[model samples]
Target: CLTASSNTDGATVVVEPCTTNNAAQTWVQNGQTLLVFGNKCLDVTNGVTNTNGVKMQIWTCTPGQGDAAQHWSITSTKTIQWAGQTECLDLSGGRLTSGNQIQVWLCENGNANQVWNLV
Candidate 1:
């Protein structure tokens, strides 16, 4: 599921499982640019490279041909691989605590948090 929070304060968010009928789950690929229906692009907050459970936020998908941060490849197994990074959309560590954050990390091949369903 892809969830989006308000950009202003990072509050007021909506969460839903990825389903075939949802437009928000639909991702459009124009060459190297990806566009979500709600104009939300995947972002790793603060441009931190290491995992360590940093927050993931949604921002506008910018125009660029080979920006590594914006590049994503959905594997046949539904895991999302961020462009040029070995880390996948990880949910590891634990349930998303109220103040805790999400991050991309090395694929430990576990199911607790590293597993994600890309729509």
Candidate 2:
């Protein structure tokens, strides 16, 4: 589950086991961005840098603002990539444990850390 640390802007986005009736785990895909807490969009921290290992977070939704950092799409290969960027959402250190924060790193073919499946 992609969870927000809190129902507020600038909340850390982490992976947690999907649970019933958990609002934090509920995400809504609005266009190319994922939204949590109703108005926060999943964003890449300092996304303009496009640096490897930058953590993901929830920020105020900037719909139709052409903010590449907030634009995301799941590719045919099951990897989530940001608009016009080569980086994809990655599992930090490739760990599968809960509470693992997601990051953005260079997209690599066959990299399990970058793969995601919509449930």
Candidate 3:
């Protein structure tokens, strides 16, 4: 069960376990399209190419897609890696300060601030 933040600056986003009775947890893949929650699609902001604490958001799934935010590829280890960059989604430098934003940055092993669990 991987939990993604709702936004780089918002609350935690939990990926509920996919159970036989929960279709929302089921991920539908068609080529590059990822059908999340059967409706909402994960997206990044615009097509920005920076890995320094960029914002992440969600929107209605589209056909052709929009930006790198919408482009995510899951690794064999089940880690969610952003497409445009090799950076993995990470917490804000382990500051834990209020309003700390999340960003995609280079994977640095099991850094607590970088280590994320798929719920």
What TM-score against the true fold does each predicted structure earn? 0.64, 0.90, 0.56
Count of backbone clashes, every candidate in sequence? 2, 0, 8
| Candidate 3 local lDDT, 43-102, one digit each (tens) | 555536655666544566666753445667666655567775767656666665544555
Q: For candidate 3, list the clashing residue pairs, or say none.
A: 1-118, 1-119, 2-118, 2-119, 8-102, 43-69, 44-69, 44-70
Candidate 2 residue spans exceeding 4 A from truth: 63-66
Candidate 3 segments whose C-alpha is farther than 4 A from its true place: 1-37, 64-67, 95-101
Residue 64's lDDT within candidate 2 is 76
Q: By lDDT, who's the top model here?
A: 2
Q: Summarize candidate 1's per-residue lDDT along 1-119 as a digit string, tens digits.
A: 55544443232223444457665446566554455554556666655665655566656665555345556666666666666677766654655644334567765555456655543
Q: After superposition, how far is residue 97 of candidate 3 from its true place, in Å?
A: 7.8
Candidate 2 worst ten-residue window by lDDT? 60-69
The TM-score, computed over Cα atoms with residue i paired to residue i, of candidate 1 is 0.64
- lDDT, each prediction: 0.56, 0.84, 0.54
Q: What would the per-residue lDDT of candidate 2 be over residues 17-95, giving only the tens digit for each residue? A: 8888788887777888887777888899877555899999888988574377899888999999987889998999988
Clashing pairs in 1: 91-113, 92-113
